[model samples]
Target: MADVPALVLDFGGPVLLTPFEMAVREPEGVVRDLFLEQGPLATRQRPDPLWADLQEGRLSEREYWARKAQAWHEAGGSAPDVPVMFESLYSPPGPRMIRPQARALLADALAAGRRTAILTNDMRAFHTQDWIDGTEIIHTVDVMVDGSVEGVLKPDPELYRRLAQRLGVDFADMVFVDDQPHNIVGAEALGIPSVWLDVTDPDASFDRARTLMGLDEVVRDG
Candidate 1:
């Protein structure tokens, strides 16, 4: 670990587990189909594009949800059940922890006196109790910059800058890790180094820039 000491983490893909096939893709597909069938006008309104923008912080979640709900109502759907949809999207079949490798890396870093922090874009009201309950991972971090709490989301320079300020570290000394390429690119643009945790690729190596195969790696690398 560097003496300057700071590691910024993305919650969803790196620490909090995500069910790619079920919670993500499946729900996204279901929502898309629901929109297509009930709200044909959504095509003209471009709900998907709007959602992407919202995710990237180009639009507020409240605004996105309001517009989406209106579109669903106009399309003859029952307001698209926003809360239920989000619950389904984030509620994985089983809670998951980072793989042992990643955990080790993080542990090593922390043991070496590095500060660890999380920077994630998540809903304000979404409770993370179920995911962190009885999990040792929560204790590993020094601070958590939840987007909901910060009112700023990733892919935006504001979020990155705010986190660096809060941590009292320079952007160049901070390393951000997330599974999404766009997120990595966004952090890179702000002069923060990034690690892409591509869990989908069996042959992908996390060794490039302190990437980890799993949580164990974090402990070991740390």
Candidate 2:
């Protein structure tokens, strides 16, 4: 982690907070609850086949949703009302907060003259650039390698390498943090020191990350 010139952050669980992670943290509302409310058959609904294509920018957002609805019905579940589900599931009540510790860590890295980038397996079905653009976190980011835009996702070493190249940073000197163990292994395989963050335990994850980055302890609220 020495001589870390850049920090490559994962968007979902590591940087921008996600409901999936929150479900694990709070244990009150799980993702399956939504499906259960729809119908018992809804639980059998499989992932949309066009999901990857949609994320990779190969399919239009509208087409993805239509295909997604079709996928649900095909799986014996009543298709969700797209608008209602979108607001209830994707756009929850919260304005989605970034982990406070993550924000602090990025700020510290940037203040110390380190470059920061966001590398995420994303679905750009709707306009979310506003979230990133308007957030304070964007100020620290030097590049964002989104799967939808890049047509590549994490655990694909090529995506990480391409992101590194795009940021003009050597893989060896980049510090990456992802919540997925598979992604961590993938980055490490490329000789990049990567941290596995447990988003449910953000403070502990960031503490371990600070240790990996050769940084001293920091106090930040969740």
Candidate 3:
């Protein structure tokens, strides 16, 4: 095995551009505008008391998603469930959903014989089977541990431990990256080095991961 630190990445915001980002950049129609443009990204730009419930942990991620899915269905979206809703919102061109920087980082890391894994809370929950199978990053990674499949979510210490155990690496030798603060803390609590990805400034976060993993130059936007 390569002696370099193993890299663990969260799937949503860290690996794929979040649905919110996609929605804002690629507005499909009324459904996109209703559930996404008026939801998370909107909450990010302006304070919404309900969204605050999510930040403060009063609302579970599932609860928030359920609310959005329900609203979308009620607003005439064809997909009634989260998974279908997600596929509809995200659309085809699966590879394009991945951040370019993330793609570069994973390519270089794997090329260097580093072990990389995706630890996601919602890979299975929010995606169709075909989508997961077709996603290049999903196939490229050394391993993927999803909470929806494993019946646990991030910020839960057990999830972190399970990932380390599966990789057969100690927490000290792994670098974890996640966009959620709570998930980062969970990994760090176990002595894992982590980078909290700032979605607004993603390049900076990827730079920090590169430094921590002893990788070469950062991926610059061209």
Candidate 4:
């Protein structure tokens, strides 16, 4: 870990603490049903559509919301309500806390002078303001490379490469962590070592290169 020059973090599962499944559970199904009942044209230009564009850094939040509002009007859906929806999507059920050990590990890394950044494939509709309010974890990072702002999605080597470039570090010199296996594999293919974080376990034990509990062990081991 000390040898590594930079660390790349994933947002959804790591830094931006939220129970995404629950947050979108109700709205997602309803939205999908609406889309199914309607045509692609009616739904394709909506806020969620900005998801892809945001992932590719092709659309900004402001632009996405405006278009979405218009799309909703055209589709006869309720007028696009950005503030309400944004708050609903990004708001957490309760206070989201960082894993104490994980936080300690990150603080140590930063104290040791290592560079760190956030690289998440987040939704376009969700704003960073929600993240700022919801969690205290993000304050530890040096950079925030959100896919929604970058216009690139993970599992895409280009995104990893771009992040590395932005951090001014070589891919091999970085260690990335994410909860998704595919994302881990994708980073590995690019020569970036990665750890798969599983935050649900009570014991918090992780297999080699795969973390089920927290990143303390990985940081210590690396």
TM-score of each: 0.60, 0.65, 0.89, 0.57
Error of 3 at 184 (Å): 0.8
In candidate 2, what are the lDDT values of residues 155-212, reduced to their tens digit? 7888987898888888888888986676788899999888888644679888777776
> Against the unseen true structure, what C-alpha lDDT does each candidate score?
0.59, 0.64, 0.81, 0.58
RMSD of each: 6.9, 7.4, 2.9, 8.3
For residues 85-138, could you state the per-residue lDDT of candidate 1 as single tens digits?
445444442334345435655666577567788787773344455544545675
Worst 10 residues of 2 by lDDT: 34-43
Best-fitting candidate, measured by TM-score?
3
Ranking by lDDT: 3, 2, 1, 4
Model 3 misplacement above 4 A: 35-40, 43-46, 217-222
Instruction: Please estimate how well model 1 matches the true structure, expressed as its whole-model Cα lDDT.
Output: 0.59
Query: Which ranking of candidates, highest TM-score first?
Result: 3, 2, 1, 4
lDDT, model 3, position 164: 82
Clashes of each: 28, 1, 0, 8
| Ten-residue region with minimum lDDT total, candidate 4 | 33-42
lDDT of each residue in 92-144, candidate 4, tens digit only: 62333344434554665676577878887754445546555556567568877
Candidate 4 clashes: the total is: 8
